[model samples]
Target: MAQYRWSYTSLQGKRYIVGLFHGPKTGHLMIYVNSKIVQIDFKVFEEKVYSFFLEEDLCEITIKKDNGSYGYDFQINKEVDTPLNRKRKAFNKVNRNRIITMFVGLGVFLAVIITFGISQKRKKEREKERYLQEMLAKKTVSATATIDSVKWSGDQASFYFKFYEGDIQRARIELIDKAAVDLYTQGLPVLKGDEFMMTYYTYNDSTSLKLNEPTNLQLANFMYRAFEQEQKSQSHLSEEELRCRVKCAFRVSGISGLADVYFQAETRESNPWHNRLTYNKLVRDIPFQEAFNEYCLPQ
Candidate 1:
């Protein structure tokens, strides 16, 4: 095997630089910087070289055989400085109009930002006023009309409130707690379908207030119970028990995308018993999760 040293420097302050490495057919190359893996397509090896410019700094590089995770070699190098003349020449190419245009562009951006800030502030004030007015109206209504009855369906794990007047114009429900999201993925045959389901209501905005419309009530109840049980049961439940409980709670709602394989398990009751537990046994992955674990998480 052969090795090479590459150098890069930038006068543009700082920016992230990335590249890939490809070589002769002995599997593929995995490029890692500071112990994080970067992608370099193996099929591109026919062209032979993969490199890119980065800001001047020390960087770690690791080359490993693909298809297998453990076979690899690594190195680190510092970017060396070069003559600043070329960088100065590039900077000087800016003419009078470009500077003025850039300033004007910046001014417009600032104006837009200020305008947006004012609009948002006004909008928030309006919302607050509207909320206060609604509260006053509700108090008046409640004093006269029958108070809404909140019915809790234990099986459904949700309180269903019915207002006697004006079509029950207001409702609010929320669930918030600290918990680590556990994901279980298994492959499914391409001939069938891939599926995913989450146990909790996804909160985004006021527009999504009607989450109950698409939510599987049965699954919600199951998941709610499961969550409660998980919290109260044993402090040291095995990963398998946690996985089983979560999978038992969640069921596939639908499927899309044609890829290697797909399956999801969560704590919800929307799917068939055994089928929701089905697995085609394929590798599951996510880039950001791995990145977070590798770069940001404490060891």
Candidate 2:
């Protein structure tokens, strides 16, 4: 019998252990964190030397049997020194130097700098929290809308609907990505006359609304395609052009509000960085009427 062991710290700062034991005809492998086994696998012995791959950790392990009993040679291969690793190392070095400097003659200056940095960070965090709270505190309006039209182009779609809130009757448009459209239609074709209940929050100074329902699948297949398309074209286009391209697709059918809702939800969750700043700013202040005139209305 032979035994081998390897250990490494994960990117998330968690320690893990990988152990392998080889007998006459079979080999057993175990992976653990803090002495709690997380994975176990078995392989049939083929030769004196055996190699296998671990998918979870992206590592390869080779074990060789030695002449002496209870002896084995272990070799573990892992990708280290990546860009993230290098950045972490650099950050650690800088932090270490800063700590050392603070302990020396410049302690008062370092203390003042650290205090100012922390104060600024806390102020920004408080501002963000206040913004979210204000948004959530707004009044919610509920109404039912009948889909009057459905338009599709490329990976985007628009739904035109009419609704009545109290005595006020209005026609509204909602935009959705191809993934949301797929979900709304249940893989079937979308048509006019579909209906849904909409609950949205309205801003005080503007007629802009934030939707509160139909949380679309975050990792839909069409979303992946959209990401791929953005990645391919992002390098060639300016920030403004990319923003206009995304906004224009949903704007033509006057469903820009729906697009805003979708993007806002995605930003709150996990949105890609390509044109993110531009898209976020575009939808930040504009109401539905302004967006419709700028992008949807024919000049």
Could you tell me how far off, in angstroms, the CA of residue 187 lies in candidate 2 after the best superposition?
2.3
Q: Which ten residues in a row have the lowest lDDT in candidate 1?
A: 178-187
- Candidate 2 residue-wise lDDT, 1-299, digit = tens: 55556776665676666666556455565544446655566763443444443333345454444553334444434346545546666899999989888787487877899999999999999999999877766665666665688788889777777767678777866677877654443333333554456754555421222222222331232233333444354558654544444454345322332233234334433544223453455545455347646764558
Q: What C-alpha root-mean-square deviation, in Å, does candidate 2 show against the real structure?
A: 30.2
* Whole-model lDDT, model 2: 0.52
- Candidate 1 lDDT tens digits, 1-299: 33343433344654343333445556465453433455445543332333422343334554545553323233224233433434444556666568889999999999999999999999999999999877655444331111122233432222222222345444433221112111111111211111122122113212111222222433343344344445344348664554343443232222111111122342225422222233222112243234334444457
Best-fitting candidate, measured by lDDT? 2
TM-score: model 1 vs. ground truth: 0.17
TM, every model:
0.17, 0.29
